[model samples]
Target: MDIAILSVSLNVHSTKRIVEEGQKAGHYVELIDHTKCSVKLGEGKPQIYLGEENVTDEFDAIIPRIGAKVTKHGAAIVKQFEMNNVFSTARSLGIMRARNKIRTLQIMARKGIPIPETLFSINPHNIGEQIELLGGPPVIIKLQEGTHGSGVILAESKKSAKSIIDTFYKMDTSILLQKYIEEANGEDIRIIVVGNKVVASMKRISDLDDFRSNVHRGAETEAIKPTAKEQFIALNATKYLGLGVAGVDIMRSKKGPVLIEVNASPGLQGIEGATGVNVAQQIIQFVEKNGHRSRK
Candidate 1:
């Protein structure tokens, strides 16, 4: 099987690991930078190419190592693969929805998945009332599209919340105001779910005072097995998002397990290192089991 590892850099850890694992598994794997690829639509289907080189249909699957900011173009390349009958770990629609926070949270709530009680308003008229609904002060305000703890703000007071909301309103950016879970203790669980199995998990602990638990934000990680309810939340979130593999982030709230978000292209470094598990191997085996391929 020939596998195309779609990523922005072949030097990346997860990208390198998956490419090496696929090679060890006796599959022909090519690392194609999605940023350098383009899609063309024609009579029967769409075709994708890296520069002038046409991507072949013989490839078994595309493991998209897409970044959050490039969700649109990155998933566009994956969608082209779909048109040519090539498979991906995540479908285009799934990728798009997972990248959009408010949409993802709404879909999860609709599917009966527990998440932070969040409120959104496009109209500035509802800002004041929305803050009241969120129970005032120290709420979580986040941009519709941000990752790695970049665009999230902890509004510690009603004045701060008002200021942030007003700023976003002035900038014409939609934002979500969520009730902050105090007991989360600057920590959260990152569960890697492949198919019906929870492959690995890491409890990411942030710095003493920060709200974000991302490793890039000086957070530390330790391997921890999720509870039954945490497992359920992770699995159901992945299932509802129509993803074959996911990184399900959950917080241990007083109300029970609250799912924070589900990531389609989750980083493999921290989880695999903390757990000493072969996450890349698991992902490759999953693709081999599920991906569509044609005779060369």
Candidate 2:
């Protein structure tokens, strides 16, 4: 099979691993930097290009490892591939939905998936009311498109929450507020789903001084077997978002397990290393099944 890993660079650990595994699986895999890709429309058939090279029909499948910074362009490129009948691990719409916390949460809420109590608003006039909606502070504030725990904030007091939320509203930055689950204790679950099944899962423990349990935030990880409920949520979340591969993040609250977010372009490094699961290979195999069917 001819596969393309749509990413910024082959130097990224996850990107490199996928390329190696795809090659080992006897497939011709290439790294197509979506940043350099463009599309031409209204010429009868849409055409996609990589710099000077036309890539309209270059591959049978694409595994997009899109970054938060280039999500729009990357999803556009992936959309072009979809329009051209190429199989992709993530659909274009799914990429966009997963990029924003509000959008993802909306879908999850509509689908009856358990998620943290979340609220979003743009009105700065009622900052206190907004915080009150989530039952006041110790609230979780998150930038809509934050990645790797970069824009998540914990406001431990009403004053701090009001100030932070007002600042975001005044600046026109998109953010969401959620009731912090103190029981989680800075720990969360990451379940890697490929083709309707959970291939691997891990528990991420945040550093003592931090509340975010992201691997990039220097968190510790250990392989974990997700409970049946957690597995159900992860699989359904991926399906609802139209993604063949994803990382579903969950936190065990006092009530039960609630989803925090779903990542369309989930990184393979931490999950793979912690679980000793060849998640890259699972991705390749998923593509192999669906990529062939798409061709048919």
Candidate 3:
């Protein structure tokens, strides 16, 4: 089978790993830089161009490693592939929804998945009320599209929370407020799901001075086996999001395990290193099964 890994660069760790694993499994794999891809419409059937080459039907499957900054255009390329009947690890709509925090949370909430108390508002006038709605300060202020904990801020007091939120709103930046789970102790769970199976999971502990537990934020990781409830939430979150591959993040709050985020293109380095799992190979096998089935 021929595979396309839709990513910005082949130098990225995840992209390299996927390519290596695909070749090891006897599949022809290549990187299609989504940033360099264009969609042509009208005239006849719609076509996608990678530079000057028409890539409308070049592969059996696509594994999107779409970056946060290029999600809009990246999803468009993936959508074009989908319309041409190509199998993708993540659907275009799912990629779009997962790129935005509020959209993912809304879908999760509606699907009865456990999540933290989250609120989103664009009204600058009701800033104070919005914070109060989440039980006041010490809340988390996060950019709707921020990744790797870049725009996630923890306000320890009502005054700071209100000030930070007001600044973001004044700048017309999209943001959301969530009830901070202090009991989590700067830790969270990342469960990697391939197809319908939970392939790997790990606990990320934050740096002593930081509250965000993302590995890119210098968090330490260790292997973990999630409980039945955690596994249920992770699996269902992936399913409802229309993802064949996902990374579901959950925090242990005083009440229970509440989901924090869902990653459509989950990184393999951290989870793979922590759990010693051949996650990249699992992804290739998943593609082998579904890609062939889709062709049939």
Could you give candidate 1's per-residue lDDT for residues 75-182 as a string of tens digits? 888888877788788888888888889889999999898898899887776666888898877799998888888889998888888888898999998778899999
Q: lDDT by residue for model 3 over 1-296, one digit each (tens)? A: 98999997888999999999999999889999999999999999899999999888778899999999999999999999999888999999999998899999999999999999999999988888998999887899999999999999999998898889899988999999999899999999999999999999999999999999999989999999999999999999989989999999999988889988899999999999999999999999999989853442
Instruction: Give lDDT tens digits, candidate 2, residues 1-296.
Output: 88999988989999999999999999999999999998999968899999999988779999999999999999999999998999999999999999989999999999999999999889988889888888878999999999999899999999999999899988999999999999999999999999989999999999999999999999999999999999999999999988899999999999999999999988889999999999999999999889953442
Cα TM-score per model: 0.96, 0.98, 0.98
Clashes of each: 0, 0, 0
What's the lDDT for residue 200 in model 2? 98
Give candidate 1's error at residue 254 in angstroms: 0.5
Whole-model lDDT values for every prediction:
0.87, 0.93, 0.93
Candidate 3 Cα lDDT to native:
0.93
lDDT of 3 at 41: 97
- Cα deviation of 73, candidate 1, in Å: 1.3
